[model samples]
Target: MSRIEARIEDLGLALPAPMLPPGNFKLVNVYGGLAYISGHPAIDGSTVLVQGVVGRDLTVEEGYEAARLAALSIIASLKHELGDLDRVTSWLRAVGYVQSAPEFHDNAKVVNGFSDLIIEIWGEAGRHARSAPGQGPSPLDVPVIIDAIVAISE
Candidate 1:
């Protein structure tokens, strides 16, 4: 197994199957050693494991886990395209959208779930510039959505 995969195993993280795009867009596209992943819902394909607005029905911790799940979905998409996690050179950036109430502004703390998981698996290389925002809703009203960019070595 790749080092990242091994680390994921150690950390009790398993890559979920990449979600098929609900529309015409592709899940991921790679060119020039960069992979751009589409926004991933926090669903596990069966259903959304978490739902509702942050600070209303869900706590920040709950939102964090949801974001982590979204990140895992992106990782699954990456593995689908690249065949091996070890080929990843670095996490370039991430965009996180949170379905949240207007009063809640802790989107960054929620997105840290994904960042922390990446750091656990990729060490320093996984740290990246990130944008997290409170949004009105997502495809399924899921608590979180995430998209990522990763650089890979050929």
Candidate 2:
């Protein structure tokens, strides 16, 4: 296995099969050494792992785990596109959306789940700019959605 893949296994994680876009949009776009990945929910195929509004039906910890799952889905897509996780040079940006209750305001904490995994897998290369936005509801009623931009070596 590649070093990155080993790291994922070391972390007790495995990438799921890449998800197909439910709509006409593409899952990944590569240009100028950057890979732009579309938003993905915490799902394995059509199985929604976690679904609920944060601070209401779900706790912040649950939301955090959901965000992590979303990030893993994005990574699976990246691997599918590049054919090798080791081709990743660096992470550029990540944007996480949290489906939240009106009183919920811990989006960043939830999104940390995604960021934490990236760092764990890629070390310094995983550090990147990030944004966590709260939304009323997410598609398919998922608790989290995550999208990423990554730098890759040709």
Candidate 3:
């Protein structure tokens, strides 16, 4: 296994299945050289894992963990479609929205979870521009919502 895959194993993580679309769109689409993955809830099975606004009922650290779980969900989606995380070239972009109290403004720290994971997996190539913002509640009332744009090779 590649070092990244080995690390995931060491972390005791196995990417879960990509969620089925709630509407009409595809879960992931590869066009040209980019792969666009749909937004996913931070859920594990029937339970929504994390909830509440950050800086309110949730701490930035807890939000960080929620974001980490969201990243893992994306990896699961990638594995489902590509069969191998090694095919990913770079994590081109990420758009993260954090559910937080109106007074809270530390969205970037929460999203670092996702950012850190990409860097851990693809090294320098995983680094990318990201948008992390405090927003209204996400679907399923999760603490965070994340989506990714990745570049891959066939």
**C-alpha lDDT of candidate 3 relative to the true structure:** 0.83
Which candidate gets the maximum TM-score versus the true structure? 2
lDDT string for model 2 (1-154, tens) is: 7888889899899888788789998798999999999999988866778889989999989988998888888888888889999999999999998999999999999999999988988999999999999998678899889888999999
List, residue by residue over 1-154, the lDDT tens digit for candidate 1. 9888888899887888667778898888898989888888776654667889998999999999998888788888888889998999999999899999999989999999989988878999999999998899677878888888999998
* Model 3 C-alpha lDDT per residue in residues 1-154, reported as the tens digit of each score: 7666787998787766566666898778889888998876566534567888898989999999889888888887777787777888888889889999999989999999889977876789899999998898678788888888999888
How high a TM-score does candidate 2 get? 0.97
TM-score of every candidate: 0.95, 0.97, 0.91
Ranking by lDDT: 2, 1, 3
lDDT score of residue 153 within candidate 3: 85
Question: Which lDDT value does model 2 have at 62?
Answer: 93
- How well does candidate 1 score on lDDT at residue 34? 90
Runs of candidate 2 with Cα error greater than 4 angstroms are: none
lDDT scores in order: 0.87, 0.90, 0.83
**Among these predicted structures, which one has the highest lDDT?**
2
Estimate candidate 2's alpha-carbon lDDT, on a 0 to 1 scale.
0.90
